[model samples]
Target: MAEVRTVAIVEDDPIIGASLAQRFAIEGITTQWWRSGEEALAGFARHRPQVVVCDIRLPDLDGESLFGRSTRLLGPVPFLFITAFGDIEQAVRLVRAGA
Candidate 1:
């Protein structure tokens, strides 16, 4: 994997999204933070990033759904899923799917 210069953040929570973007910015990484799956999907169609940090439960599509739908457009980009619910089954599924 090459050095990641940019990351796309898909998170509904304003605080978490802003914080992640801020931290990435501090490290001199460019970030495209989207508040919903629809918005992220649209942005992704325009430009795919090196990595994606997405919330498990989004406003429209869930993380898994978004991953499934974006795989073709995003290619082999890495995905990191976040969730407060701590669903082990979903985590296993995601890991198995190469998230």
Candidate 2:
């Protein structure tokens, strides 16, 4: 059987984070939900999820920086940014920059 992919979700909103985590759980995928970028970064070394779902507006560290740091640590894993702000320009920039 193929290995199940692990996914890390970095979102400040408890409701959304929990919902996303639950969704992954229902799909039988491993998930780690973090409320802050710092928390995610700290645990990333141990978890090393193949995919990361991050919110752009975090408490201490923003998603852009988090994505960059994650890439540096794990060598460019897939990152899916989620934000209510919905800034297309910024998203384009992030994607162009390899986030």
* CA deviation > 4 Å runs, candidate 2: 1-4
Tell me the tens digit of each residue's lDDT in model 1 across 1-99: 589998999999999999999999999999999999999999999978999999999989888999988887787789998899858898899889889
| Candidate achieving the largest lDDT | 1
Write down the lDDT of every candidate, Cα atoms only.
0.92, 0.90
Output the number of the TM-score-best candidate. Answer: 1
Residue-pair clashes per prediction, in order, are 0, 0
lDDT of 2 by residue, 22-88 (tens): 9999999999888998999998988898889999999999899998898988887889999988688
TM-score of every prediction relative to native? 0.96, 0.92
Model 1 CA deviation exceeding 4 Å by range:
none
